[model samples]
Target chain A: MCTYATVHADMDGSAKGPGSEWFHVTAATVYFDHPVHAMAEHTLNIDLADAAKGPNGRVALELRADSARALIKAIQDALDSVPEELRV
Target chain B: MSEQLTARTIQITGANGDEIQAYLATPDETDEPGPRGAVLVIHHMPGYDRASKEIVRRFAELGYDAICPNLYWREAPGAAPDDAAAVARAQGGVPDERLLGDAAGAIAYLRALPTSNGKVGVIGYCSGGRQSVLVACNLDVDAAVDCYGAFVTGTPPEGSLRTNLVDQLPNLRAPLLGMFGKDDKYPSPEHVAELDDILTANGKPHDFHSYDDAGHAFFSVDRPSYRVAAANDGWAKIAAFYGEHLATTASTPTGA
Candidate 1:
């Protein structure tokens, strides 16, 4: 399983709305690079409010399904796999 | 002190049956004649009180209506209790959902009010600084000003006084103007740089200023953290930013 949080920021590339007035997110799509059964039941719960915090601060480490723990560890390890030179 | 708009306090329902007490102040232009703009002043986690209303009074002097909301609606009541317990209780309780929900309610309230010119904007300092950002993100506002507030970053510090504001940047939409002091311990220069990088990478329209002599919250001239020169400069720039954006909407002179 693969899953990480994402921020639904200004689509117009502006920190705020232009003529529209309010800034809001209609939907958010989470990313997970891991493999799960095609038919496996999966759900993701996210706090849209925390997306501004970036990686560690933005999202917490919890699972959505039966193997959530395993999924989180797998994704985190993949992130930790960067070579020192390629870490950039 | 200049003339101010008569303020009204009303109890409004928030997310999940929460009762939020909101303060609305508008420029009493009906008596003075001529129409001015309106400003939505979101208060910090400190909650609405005398200090917060005075801020609204200052905005009224600037020839605009200002409304402030008590975002701490869900927090346990009996504020302060005693003077000696102030420092301890300030750290007691503030849930993320509670504050955000209350702010959302406040935004709705401002939009429905008759006295408002409808060209609304939001600004806050410290905890309120980030709150302003959140309100701007989720609601429609002309402008947003964040002063020495929390910014989202890579790592979390252990002693962080606030957590939710740190994670809400991606939802941002309002044209943001951030003012920070080099000495602000919470948001160090590096933190500001990281935020700059992300915002620039995302191609967000943002302007950020940091002063070396000033540290965290130089806005309050009466406080210990206040710096005369930096505060004045930041204040003027903020005023200019609001004047450029919030003060003018579709109906105003240059708004068209």
Candidate 2:
């Protein structure tokens, strides 16, 4: 089923995308919906994009529900391991 | 019918008279003696990709001129299907008015074809299913098919702009054929029941079939959700439904 629900965020970051080039991504769109290429029926999809650079300037990920949750915890743990001043 | 058909991307005036790309398919001239009924195939939320175009070609092989307008053209023109879909999704999806206008334009384009029999129907999968029903309610289509579309009988979740189409039920202007999977939860069995009840109350003409042991996107061949048994039967039912309601000899009904 198409979740038809989306969660959006504004962020400032650079990510390697198409053509192995790096581009500044300004927005993140997250949703749990049907995967475009994943083998699973549904997955948690995330797209970090720069709208001004057009559709090609983006990175996409489709991870299973469990994997996505694990990723969240891993991200939190990595940040926690860093010193407060160095984290910034 | 022969498998010989031609399909190509063509520009058509769509929502707000914008020239948007669309895939149009027509059967070989030798297969049919004269004009044939047309079908406006609406692609799923996955965007207008190869799978949807294959469906359009299938309709042509089945003896109908079929066209699928790229609903995401205005969002990310010339972008890949997945890319365009992402842009459209981030933009809160296509507005209801824009879709309505696009469908209307596609219908007109089909009707104006020299070999058109002046009869047109609409069929859609996933989100397109709900949009198919929406067009039937607001346009002059002769037939409408909804394949496992959600948000038709139940409300969209909070924060989503899509609303239930129950109020628009009374405005339906064509015969509707709905196919659903009993195992699907979005348009669950309960939701299908509710839709049946409302269509009955509105005195609309409809035929609904729910397949057992299947779920949403059962017709999507590329996905693991594809159920061959259910999809085969659903296709047969769709062909017959269009034959009954969208045949050239079928009587035209007054539009709302």
Candidate 3:
């Protein structure tokens, strides 16, 4: 069944998408629901998209729940490892 | 029995008079000139993709003119199915009023076909399932088939765009046929029972079949949830139900 649960947020980033090309992503849509290509029935699906560039400017990910949580922590850890002055 | 059919993408007037994309399937013209009923096949939340188009073709094989409107067209016109679906999902999904207008438009398109018999039905899976029931309550369709649709009875999770249809079932205008998996929790057995009770109390006609050893999306061949026994039987049930309610008749569209 589709969970129909979504969390939308405005963001700024660049991610590689189809054709191995990279584009600036302006928003993120996150949800835990049935995956399009993931082997699992349900996963933590996220879409990083640039609405101005249309639907093609999207980088999608479908990770297992635990893996997604680990990724969140890893991102935080990577940022923490960098000095504040260098990050700025 | 599967038969020779032709499928194609076409543009039709959709909700708000928007020219939206749609997939249409029609069978080979037979020697006999008998009229036939038509069907509107609503694609699931995943958008209008191959699997849903196959179902549209299957309806043609079953001797009905069928069409599945691309609900994501406004968001991602000409984009791949998965990509379009992703865009629609991020945009908060299709609005209910738009969905109803699209359905009504599809029905009108089908009835205008030369072979139409003025009877039209609707069948939808998953999220489309709930939309199917919703349209039946608000439209004058001949029959409605809801396959494992969630939120028709159960409360949608808070913050979700979906909602239960308990308030609309009383206004259902057509005979309803529902297929479910015993293991589906969204519209679990309890939810199904509650829907049955409500429909019965409202004096609405309905038939529901729940299969054991099956869960959500049991008919989705591409998904792991597909159950051969359940899907096969469910298909048979749908054919019979449509045959009875959407039987061909010598009449014209009242546009109802």
Candidate 4:
């Protein structure tokens, strides 16, 4: 068994509609050949608010790492599926 | 026609008689004008032993006092022979905690510099990237940029690097922007989105941009995975974001 799973990863779009129109995360080119070189996992947290006459406010993220590589295919598939709009 | 930039250092006493050294880069005092803002740049696991001053030098070009502190100074030479060796030092060790704490102190130290305008920002790569968010979460600085940092996922959390960054994302008083590569193996897109979701949900003013074609450390020119296009775009975005949020404007009361 692959022992992996797939996720939206916001490739389809973080908040919806076209991919290009949404924010995107790139790939791990350094670890493809050696999945173990880049394996890691952690959760991200953010707080929303109103400021400077702006609708959105500050956001923060927390990450935790184990070794280097965790699951490869799941992350790759999400990248390949991102909408054309999100592609760099 | 580029003027010669100056390089200098400062000695900081960490615990256990360890003397921490920092690398500082300043624009030519001969320049016709002063800097726009001041920024402290932190390097990744490769240490100050790797990479160029040009990245931080570019900050000086933008008219800001720039400093890149080497957090690894506490270690003896040749300590981390490889990535794993460095990882061992970074995960759950006194050096790691002290380095991070020192980073916070560096922020304060810069804020006090005679050249400082009280407005400051921080930028980091890889481990340094993770630290940028961590520092901003715990401080009252102007802004921060986290480039392709490792993120957390799942209920229990998976990272053992021992950084509390992922958990503190919701508490940043200043706007933080994170850039990641979608194809990155360590920090998957799912994880990146989880971060975005948390920020959006909390009403935090943050934006995470993951380049579709780029990968981990894509901005790192010295690495094999460096993506020219992505790095260029990222640099522009970061600069603009800082200009909007951190830089001082004639109309704004104080520029951060």
Candidate 5:
């Protein structure tokens, strides 16, 4: 269906990008659309990127809907396990 | 049979006269007489990747000069195709006006070639499919092919950036060949039927074929959605349609 809906978030973090080099990530673009490599017809895709570093400066993931939801829960659980004071 | 052809990347004028990257393919010059028709291959929303380039070459092998403009060049120049697509998608995708402009540029480039027969056809897959119809309605194209394009007759989800071309259908200026999969949800059976009715009522020439056992992207060989039978038959339809509309005749004049 090539869903055109996309959600963008500004972020301050670092991730391993092309060439296995770590780059400061400035934004996250999330969408449920056709995947480049995934076997499924559609998947939840996330691209963590550093715009200033050009296109190659991206860390990408394509997960099934269920996998994406599970990942979200996992992230929330990991954050919750930290002390309130340590959460930031 | 494989035809001798040459393919390369070149820069062409796009929307606002911006120089953007494009892939161009043409059959090798031989003793073959008369100029050849041209085709504008619109890449899907996935951006101008290798598959899209291969499609352009396929048209060339079919003896048509073909070109595919990089729709994301303005946003992510020098970027890998997938990266460029991600960047473009985040930006709400390419605007309709900009798409029309870039298509016009590509068509112009094809027509300007010395070997062109001044006839141009357009073919697009996925999102490009809808754009193909949009371009046909707004431009002076000879033929158009829409391969399972969504939102051409159906409503997109709420807050989605996509829109249908119901109003534009009345202005369709070329013969259209639509290939769809009955199992596909987007542009489902009902939507395709609706489109068929509108074009019929409008007196627009259209040939639509819906495959029973296929779904969306049946023509995408690299994807799991690919349906060999549907894809092969769709290709045959495309070739026949273009042959009828784009073939050079003795009475036809060359040049843009």
Candidate 6:
């Protein structure tokens, strides 16, 4: 089934994208839906994109649901390890 | 039967007179000697990718001229299928009205073909499956096939903009052939039963089949969900249904 459920977030950052070039990333679109390449029936997909750069200017990830949750925890743990003054 | 066919990407006018890219396939003129019926193959939510194009070609191989419009063309023209799909999904998917317009345009293109026998059908997979039924309800198609499309009779998951077509069932103009996987949760057995009851109550012509061992997207050969037994049977059913509804008459010269 196509869930048709999506969430979006605006961001200011940089990431390496297509053609091995770095681009300013301004948005992230996330959804759990049928993956284009993942072998699973469904996966949590994330697109870190620069909409201004068009569709191809982005890094995409499709992870298993459990993997996505683990990633979230890892990210939180890493951020928590930083000194409070250095966090910003 | 000749296996020879021709296929290519072409341009067609879509919603609001916008020119969109489409893939078209047709049997060789010499192989099938008559005005042929046409089919509008709606791509799934994944956008117009290689698999969708393959389905279009499969219809042509089965003797029907087929076309699949690029529903994501407006957002990501010339972009990769996955990229276009991502863009379209983030943009809240295609609007119902716009999809209708694109479908109508594709139908018109098929009917206008010199070898057309004045019959057109629609078949869609996944999200496209629901759209196929929607198109049949709103358009003048001769036949419709819904392959495990959800939300046709059940509530969509929360936050989904999709709505059930209960109110529109009476307006369905074509005979429908629905194929489902018994294990599919979206069009669960209950949902399929509800749809069957509604169509039956409305005196609509429909035939539905559910495979016990199959689940959602059983027809997707490229995906892990693909179930060979179910897919094979489903294709046979489609062939028979279209034969009954969209079969052409005796041979006729182009432009006759």
Tens digits of per-residue lDDT, candidate 3, B156-255, equal 8797766789998989999999999999987798988999999999999999999999998899888888899999999999999988877765554432
Model 5's chain A TM-score stands at 0.96
Candidate 5 chain A lowest-lDDT run of ten: A49-58
How do the residues B1-256 of candidate 5 rate in per-residue lDDT, one tens digit apiece? 1268889999999889999999998888872334889999999999999989989988888888999999999999988899899888877899899999999999999989998899999999999999999999999899999999999998877777668999899999999999999999988999999999999999999999999899999988899999999999998889899999999999777866
| Deviation of model 2 at A61, angstroms | 0.5
TM-scores for all candidates: the values are: 0.63, 0.97, 0.95, 0.65, 0.97, 0.97
Q: How do the residues B208-252 of candidate 2 rate in per-residue lDDT, one tens digit apiece?
A: 999999999999998899999999999999888887766666454
All candidates: CA RMSD in angstroms?
17.4, 2.3, 2.0, 17.3, 1.4, 1.7
Candidate 4 lDDT score at position A1: 7
Poorest lDDT segment (10 consecutive residues) of candidate 2 chain A: A79-88
Candidate 5's C-alpha runs over 4 A off are none
Docking outcome class, model 4:
incorrect
Clashes of 5: 0
lDDT of candidate 5 over A1-88, digit per residue (tens): 7888888899999999789899999999999989999999999999999888887789999999999999999999998899988977
Once fitted onto the true fold, the runs of candidate 4 whose alpha carbons sit more than 4 angstroms away are A1-88, B1-4, B13-19, B30-32, B77-96, B152-164, B249-256
Cα displacement (angstroms), candidate 5, residue B37, comes to 0.9
User: In model 3, what lDDT does residue B140 have?
Assistant: 75
Worst 10 residues of 4 chain B by lDDT: B81-90
Candidate 3, superposed: residue stretches over 4 Å from native: A84-88, B249-256
Show model 1 residue runs off by greater than 4 Å.
Answer: A1-88, B30-36, B73-92, B158-168, B251-256
